[model samples]
Target: MDFHKLKKELITYSKEIGIDKIGFTTANPFDELKSRLIRQQELGYQSGFEDPDIEKRVTPSLLLEEPHSIISIALAYPSKMNERVESKKGMRRGIFSRASWGLDYHHILRDRLKKLEEFILTRVPDVRLKSMVDTGELSDRAVAERAGIGWSGKNCAIITPEFGSYVYLGEMITSIPLEPDSPIEDQCGSCTKCLEACPTGALVQGGQINAQRCISFLTQTKGLIPDEFREKIGNRVYGCDSCQTACPHNKGKNFHFHGEMEPDPEVAKPLLKPILTLSNREFKNKFGDVSGSWRGKKPIQRNAIIALAHFKDETAVPELIDVLVKEASPVSRGTAAWALGKIGGEPAFAALVKAKVVETDSEVRGEIEKALNYYK
Candidate 1:
């Protein structure tokens, strides 16, 4: 089998199918990644979503029988929207990061990977292959970095010269041996822009990130967002893009190759108060297709409340009061109490005072008391 010829054919096919970048690497175990994950666990830096088995995560052979090579693919999404969302009077909108702007990237990358698998099967009828998007056990970044798709940027993203770090990544492990591509040289070069731009210092140092403090991870958590990061979260409704936007390589790197990847302006930057009013069915109808909605309605709604607090939107006080008094979810109620306190006034203060007396949940009551102190 002419593996080199197959690789070239695959590359051409990838482009034809809308893959922005593609690279090849051996299915060798990722030793460095295993150690990094162990250290991350030790330091309590993990976001709790990582697949816990380190061996399975780094070992491709375990995932696929006789895996000989891995192919990494990237698809660029637009960094800037073609049309901007105009915030109307008395309406404060929360921003979803560029990564979560359009359809959920997992689906997009998976579709590309599936097509690649089918193409390979047409050439080698019985060749074994395993494909994975972000949620797969294998680290998409590690595979992409080694495959020469891009360098692992300080922001912990794969930064391609062509598409910058604003690309979704996926990989396929195959039994067919293929020639490897040269790894990209690190070009970050003492640049600390991403580190400096991290709102919660989630980027502990360059490539290392404390996911617990990361606004992206925090926004996806079902529990109450920690006090330290809530104010830092600003108006983000889902995910965080500070590090990516701050990276020098990403400047002038917007790409809108795929229509499915284009974001609806209103959905990407939806009004804060409206978010608080979404029922489970309504939330799913509005946001289910987006990757940020994987964790479902609670986390996004909680983040919306925080965003309202960040804006100090007095207009949100009534809705927030409804959340504080009528909401069943303690996290939402507590966060609403805090938001009301943040947007302080007679109504807000009165609401908090009322909530403080009647709030059943200890956590919610504590939030109310703390919010009342803000009035002092």
Candidate 2:
């Protein structure tokens, strides 16, 4: 079998199936990435969401027995929405990052991978292959960078010359020894825009991120956000895009090739207040298809409270007071307590004082005390 011919055919088929870009590389262990990850761990920068096993992350053989090559694919997502939702005073809305603008990318990329697998199976009947996306143990960015899909950008994303970093990445390991593509040169030369633009300074330096300080990671946590980051979080209810949006390469790189990749403006920038009252079924019905909803409504709700405070929406005060008095989740109630403090008025101040007396949960009461302290 001519593996080179097969690689070319695979690239063509990938483009036909909405894969914006594809590249191939030898599946040797990611030696350089292993060291960087070790340093990342030692510096306490990991988000605790990734797999803890270092070997499985860097070694392709562990994921796929006798893996000889890796095929990396990228699907570009649109950076700007064609339709805009009003985020003005009376109709404030929370913004999800560009990555979460459309349908969940995991499913989209998985579909493309499954198609690629079937195509390969028909050519080499006994080929061994394993595919993975963002949630997989194997690092998708490392595979993409080595596979020549893009250079690993200073913001810790795969920066394709064609798509910038606004691309969803996935990979497949195979037993076939396909000739590899050359990696693109890093073009971030002396650009400090991303690091300077990070609201929480999550971008520690070029090509390194402290995920603990990242608004994207913090918004996904199912707890009260630290007081310091609350104001900095602004109106982002899902992931943060400060680093990517600030990059000069991404300035004019918006693309909407796939139909499902187009964002529904209403869903992408939903009204902040409606998010607070979404029941599990309602939340699922509304945001269930978006990738950001994987953590469920709790974090989104908590972040919504923070967004309300960021807007100082006095109109949301009545509902926020209800959350403090009647909501079951201590995280939501606690976050609401803090929002009341941030958006202070007679009603908000009174609610915080009343909740301080009756809120039995230690954490919730602590938040209540902190909120009341603002009045002092």
Candidate 3:
């Protein structure tokens, strides 16, 4: 089989398999990205992605051992279903963004990439290949841009004109040399909608993101959240899409997807009332296939309580009391106390006062005191 013909065939196959777009490029190590990663480390912007073993693979030089061809694929995940949830009037209405509304992209992208990889191997038996979704060392947006599938917006997301930034990226690193796609020019020009819309100012000037200040990272982080970000976290419990939501490029369009990228109905309008009731076992069963499950129940549960607090729904006070008294995890207990304070009234206030006497953990006690201050 001709290598060029094989590449074109691969593109067709990728589209048929429900990928939004596909393109090819040569493996060129990103020196600038490596330097950026180093800087991010120095400034503590890389808390979530701190595995040295994985960091080595993130560089193009380390990712492509022999350096031949690159195949990048984009899967668009839209908010047609979740847009209704965002349109709701009450504080129960908050955005889960779009990309994370269904099954985890890692699984969806990997299953497709594995099939694509197998097809290529059958065509060229001697060719070598490795696949990486967001988990690998290489940057998905950078590789996607290099392949000409899309341009990186000022928010640092790969933005397709048709689909905007609501896309999941995956790559196949291969030994077979193929034709390369031309890089697109930056289209952002003078746009700062993403930066301006950030609730926590995580987007610094020049398209840089300070991950520590990022609500998405903070919500998923274990242990205590820094006091600075606590109030700004608002109702978000998992990943944030404020920058993407604020981007003019993404507004007023109904970008769609096929197959695994499709949104799950259950997640579209996630019930806050039921979210507070999930056991760890139930959480795994409910969200196991979704991207939000990667951190397990602790983060989501904590965020649920915070979202309840944001709503200031006294109705949730009973549930918060149940969590504060019965939940074993410190995260659940601490956030429950915080929510009780935020929903302060006779019932909630009285419950907090009761939980405070029995709460042994210093962190939970501290939160109880904070809630107590609101009551007094």
Q: Highest lDDT, which number?
A: 2
lDDT of 1 by residue, 40-81 (tens): 999999998989889999999999999999999999999998
lDDT of 2 by residue, 129-198 (tens): 9999999988999999988988988899899999999999999999999999998889899999999999
**Residue lDDT tens for model 3, 1-376:** 5888998899888887787789888887766666777877777767566545535645555766686878999887865764344423333633455667777889889988998988888899888898999878778877898888789887878888878888889999898889898977788988888889888888777457888888888877877676667667777767888888888888875655565656666564466657878877898787787787787777777777787777887677788889989988887898888888888888888888888889899988998899899866
Write down the lDDT of every candidate, Cα atoms only: 0.92, 0.93, 0.78
- Model 2 — TM-score against the truth? 0.99
TM-score of 3: 0.92
Which residue pairs come into collision in candidate 1?
A: none
Q: Between 1 and 3, whose lDDT is larger?
A: 1
Candidate 1: global Cα-lDDT?
Answer: 0.92
After superposition on all CA atoms, what RMSD does each candidate show versus the true structure? 0.9, 0.8, 2.4
> Comparing 2 and 3 by TM-score, which wins?
2
The deviation in Å at residue 336 for candidate 3 is 1.2
Ten contiguous residues minimizing lDDT sum, candidate 3: 82-91
Model 2 whole-model lDDT (C-alpha atoms)? 0.93
